[model samples]
Target: MGRGQLLGREDGAAVFSSRTIAVAPGDDRVELGFRFSGTEVVVPDDARVVTNGAVVFGSVDCGAACAGTGTGPEITVDTSGAFGSVDVRTVTEAAADRADGDDD
Candidate 1:
């Protein structure tokens, strides 16, 4: 299936306002795109990140405990009981690196 959208529900209803990034079938992985205010972020497969909301990348679930800045959109992924790596960067820095082909 293609990308799907999940909108937030109303009061006293099933509210699912959290955005998610998922990988499509036939591919080993997928990239999740997120836009908040004026910033855009990408959460890759097998990895996770936290922002102002919650994101479920795979078997892992991530989110914030309170409503605050830079702590909402959280992401989680199954590490398969192993330690993984996480790279955090500002939107501007991320974009600059992409433009310079200096992903390291």
Candidate 2:
């Protein structure tokens, strides 16, 4: 979602991509589908992630939320010999925060 954009409560899930996926504060969920090689998924550390059929090399840094007990929303991923790894970390609420040094 764009900066200052707020999702309504009725809004559905967001689709994940290979690039940097920035999720807004009100985003409730995200769906990740990997059907090709070199696919990497990045999500916030606070998100609740559930993966199936995925072959990841590196460990997901889910932190205290790895057990699907985070206060944030859910993130589901399904891969079949396509995804390389998933890097989990805290993502800023807005993409512009990275450029304006607000994330620091």
Top of the candidates by lDDT = 2
Candidate 2 local lDDT, 50-83, one digit each (tens): 6545444433333333477666667554444333
Using all chains and alpha carbons, the TM-scores for the candidates as numbered come to 0.25, 0.40
- TM-score computed on alpha carbons, candidate 1: 0.25
Q: What is the lDDT of candidate 1?
A: 0.31
- In model 1, what lDDT does residue 51 have? 28
Relative to the unseen true structure, what is the C-alpha lDDT of residue 22 in candidate 1, on a scale of 0 to 100?
A: 33
* Model 2 TM: 0.40
lDDT of 2 at 14: 26
Report the Cα lDDT for residue 70, model 1: 44
RMSD of each: 14.9, 8.9
